[model samples]
Target: MIQIGIVGVGTVGASVARILEENQDIITARAGKEIRVRKGVVRNLSRARDVAIPLTDDVDEILDDPDIDIVVELMGGVEEPYHVVKKALEKGKAVVTANKALLAYHRYELQDVAGDLPFEFEASVAGGIPIIKALREGLSANHIESIKGIINGTANYILTKMMTEGVDFGPVLKEAQALGYAEADPTFDIGGFDAAHKLLILASIAYGIDAKPEDILIEGIEQVTQEDIAFAKEFGYTIKLLGIAKKVGEFVELRVHPALVPQREMIAKVDGVMNGISVIGDKVGETMYYGPGAGGDATASAVISDIIAIARGGKSSPMLGFKRPLESGLQLLERDAIVSRYYLRLVVEDKPGVLAKVSQVMGEQKISIETMLQRPGEGETATLLLSTHRCEERAMQQALHALFGLESVKERPVMFRIER
Candidate 1:
């Protein structure tokens, strides 16, 4: 019998405790042992959670207990959990976690701490999808080329509603909150930080590149307007908040932002809160993994899979999937050096010279406009939606700066990159 201690008993943790009892026979059969949750640690002791496991308010109860073989840290945050996980590793307990932010920062340190012990975090990246295993084991033979994913459900839900219902971002966001899809403060998910953290976890497994959320270019879906959606529909494109990691020569480009994906692409069609990841490998081509990216059951299922993998007990691989540095020696690509086609939106005064002025500024940066769209706005203003050919991030910023300086230009320009 394997005894596990859950340190959080919140949504995902509560579900973890429930599923262990509900599916005990099959779980035991598959794991080759009787897996049980001996205790759950939550901050609040009074709040009732529907689980058979014993609950406690103190983390030390689980962490200090010698009976607990697996320590499941579902606790959120960085520093505190970092210490707890480290102590668990030091105490010679196997660990499983769903905290992306924790891994985004302290993965290497924890890997060193867990030298010979089993430490699994399949739940950290893509919720229920076994993306960690795929990148670590199944696709281990191939050289990973790129990873493009819609990993955050809140932002994806908002974007999908904006595209399908013709509603604006505000209304859709409110609706998502009411439906419990978004938090009261949705910045973490909508602002792309959540996806960025998840992206870093995947990036580590694939490229062995150590990066944090602050190191990459992350943009939110908050800037997307109905006008942008209309333009995408007109051009057979769909807007998705994408976490992108691509190999460019010796550098690995890691970024999270709203991307204008072609409508025909499989990833663009992944709508309505579903998460989809498209991974391109040199030997086996592209593979798509799609499923519910969040929710109690989905995330808990992933947690249990890690637990089961631990139960099966075998030699553990290096946490980031590499025992040594990659032979190619790929470093993180600089944010300004990123090159991609872009869609730009400008609300300008309804006049003839506005287009000419914008074109001149773009030309100065050597950015050629491939498509131009003009839509009537309130009163004497017009919205100019333009798509540009591939250009470096530096040049695009320069053009934007110059265009904003033009007296004819009103409001900051909104830009989204195209991923085809």
Candidate 2:
């Protein structure tokens, strides 16, 4: 029998215990042995929980227990979970975690500490999608070219509502919160930090690049407006917040932001709370993985899969699925040097020379406009919605700065990348 100790017996933890108990016979047959949840650790022991396992307020009760063979750390945070997982590894316990933030910051260090120990984190990236296993093992034969994904369900939900119903950001966000899809603060999910953490995890497996959330460009869907949605519809495009990672020569580009994806693309069809990842490999071309990104049951399904792998004697070769750097001399591309097509929305005074002035500023920065649209705004203001040909981010940003100085320009221009 494999004895398991789960820390943070909250939503996912409770689901893990329930699944183990309810599906004991099948789980035992698949794992080749019976897996049991011996105990659970929680911050408040007084709160009633659904699971029948022994619950304790102290973490050491599970961490220090001799009979426990595996430690499941579902607790959410950076420092505390890191220390706990490190101690679990030091104690020679196999660890499975769903903590993406912890991995984003200390994955390399944990890989060092968990040498040869069966440490698994399939639940960290995209809930039950199993993209981790695909990148680390299934697609190991090919060179990973790029990964584009809609990994965060909260942002996807809001964007889908905005596009379908033509509602604004504020009302949709409130509805998402009321539906339990978003938190009260919502910054972590809506601000793209949640997807950024997941991207860092995937980047490590595919490229062996050790980068934190701060190292990449992360922009949320909060800036997406109804006007942007209308423009997307008009141009046969759909707006989605995308986490993108691509290998460009010797450098890898990682970014998370709202994108104007062509409507015909498969990824653009992934709407509502569903998560989808499109991985392009040099040998296999492109493959898509789709599923529910998060929930108690969905995430628990991933956590339990890791347990089954460990049960089948899957040794921990390397946490990031590499013994050494997969691709050396490949540095992370600087954000300012990124090149992509862009969509810009600006409010300008309703005058003939406004468009000319805007075009001149873009021309000075070496940016050429691709498509343009003008709409009547409140009073003497007019909205100028335009898409630009591919250009360097630095040049486009400079042009935007120059446009701000123009007297005809009104508010700061909203921008989204156009993905072909």
Candidate 3:
């Protein structure tokens, strides 16, 4: 029998325990043993829980227990969970986690600490999608070319509502919160930090590259307006907040931002709260994994899969991780060095020289406009929307800065990278 200890019996932890008890017969058969939740740790003891397992307030009860064979750290936070998981590894306990923020910062260090130990985190990236295993093992033989995903359900939900209903970001965000799709603060999800954390985890498995959220370009969907959605539809594009990881020569490009993807692309079709990841492998070409990004049951399904793997003694995780991507000496691509087409929106005074000034700024930066649209705004103001030819991010940003300084320009121009 495999004894499991849950360090945080929150939403996912409770689901893990409930599922284990509810599906014991099949779980035991698949795991080759009886896998049960022995105990759970929670911050509050007065709160009632639905699981049948014994609950405790102190994490040490589970950590110090001798009979526990696996330690499931569902605790959310960076440093605290890191310390707990490190100690769990030190005590010779196998670890499975769903915390992407923790892995984004300390994955390399944890890899060093859990040497030869069975450490699994399939639930960290995209809930029950199993993209992590697909990258670390199934596609290990091939060199990973690129990974594009709509990993954060909250952000995807907001963007989908904005496009389908033509609603503003604020109203859609409020509806998402009321529906339990977003948090009260919503900064982490709407700001793209949530997706950024997940992308870093995938990048480590796919490219063997170690980078934190600070190293990559992360832009939120909060700045995206209803007009932006209209522009996307008019230009045969769909706006989606995408977590992109690509191998460009010797450098690995990792970024999370709102992208204007052509409507025809499969990734653009992934809408609502569903998460979808499209991985391009040298041998497998393009493969897509889609499922509920986050729900208690969906995420618990992934956590239990790791436990079953541990029970069956199938160690295929960090065991080959960072090493599976065989491509070596790859460095993180600088944010400014990225190259892509861009969509820009600016509100300026309806004057003759306004277009000339904008064109002259683009000309100076060596950026050529591909398509342009103009709409009258409040009073003498006009909204100028344009898409540019492929250009380096350095040049495109310079042009935006110059345009913002123009007397005719009213507000800062919004930019969204266009993906073909």
Candidate 4:
């Protein structure tokens, strides 16, 4: 029998406890043992829960217990859970976690601490999507080329509404919050931090590059506007917040931000609150994985999948899918060195010299405009929406800075990368 101890019996944790009992016979058959939830740790024990398992306010009741074989840490955050997971590993207990933030900061350290013991986090990246296993085992033979994903449901939901119904971001965001899709403070989701955490986890597994959230470039969709949507429609494009990881020569570029994806692409068609990931491998070409990114039952399904894998004696594989360095020659590319096509929006004074000045600044930075549109705005302001052919991140930054300093420019410009 495999005894389970779940910390933070919140929505996902309660679902984990319930699913274990509901699917016991089949789970036992697949796991080759009777799986049971012995106890769970919660902050408030007085609050009623649906699971029948014993609950406690103290964490040591489960962590210190001798019979608990698997420790499932669903508690959110970095430092507290890191200590909990570290201690759980120190006690020689196999652990499974859904905490992406904890892994984003301390994955390499925990990987070293775990050594050979079974430590699984299939639920960390995309909920109910078996992406971790696919990257670690299924495509282990192929050299990973790139990973482009829409991993956050709340942001995807907002973007989809913006694209389909032509509604602005504010109304859609409020609707999403009312529908229970977004939190009261939606910065973590809409600001791209949630997807950034998941992207870091995948980047570590695929490239073995150790990087924190702060180490990479992360931008939100807060700047997207109706003018930008009109430009996307004119150019056969759709705006979506994307988490991108690409292998460029010896460097890996990791970034998360709103992007203008071609409307004909499969990823662009993935609308609503659905999550989709497109992974390109040198040997196998491109593959897509799509599903609900987060929900109590969906997330619990992934947590339980890890538990089953551990129960079946599947512990020999390395936690990050590599024994040593993934590729010693490959390193993390600097944020300023990234190269891609871009879409730029500038609200400026409606004057003839403004376009000439903007073009001159871009040319000075070695940026060439491919498409352009000018729409009259309120008063003397006009919206200039332009798409650049291709340019380095440094050059784009320099051009934006120069444009910002110009007297003709009214507001700070908005830009989104054009994913080709």
- Which portions of model 2 miss their true places by more than 4 Å? none
lDDT of each: 0.94, 0.94, 0.92, 0.93
Query: 139 in model 3: Cα distance from truth in Å?
Result: 0.7
Per-candidate clash tally: 0, 0, 0, 0
Give RMSD (Å) of candidate 2 vs. truth: 0.8
Q: Which residue ranges in model 4 land beyond 4 Å of their true spot?
A: none
Candidate 2 per-residue lDDT, tens place, 141-242, comes to 888999999999999999999999989999999999999999999999999999999999999999989899999999998888888888999999999999
TM-score of each: 0.99, 0.99, 0.98, 0.99
Query: Judged by lDDT against the true structure, how good is candidate 1?
Result: 0.94
Over 136-249, each residue of candidate 4 has an lDDT whose tens digit, in order, gives: 999999889999999999999999999889899999999999999999999999999999999999998889888999999999999888889999999899999999999998
Pairs clashing within candidate 2 = none
Q: Which regions of candidate 3 are displaced past 4 Å? A: 323-327
Tens digit per residue, CA lDDT, model 1, 206-296: 9999887889999999999989998999999999999999999999999999999999999999999899999999999999999999999
Q: In model 1, what is the error at residue 340, expressed in angstroms?
A: 0.4
lDDT of 3 by residue, 253-357 (tens): 998999999999999999999999999999999999999999999999999999999999876456436644453689999999999999999999998889999
**How far does residue 223 in candidate 1 sit from its true spot (Å)?**
1.0
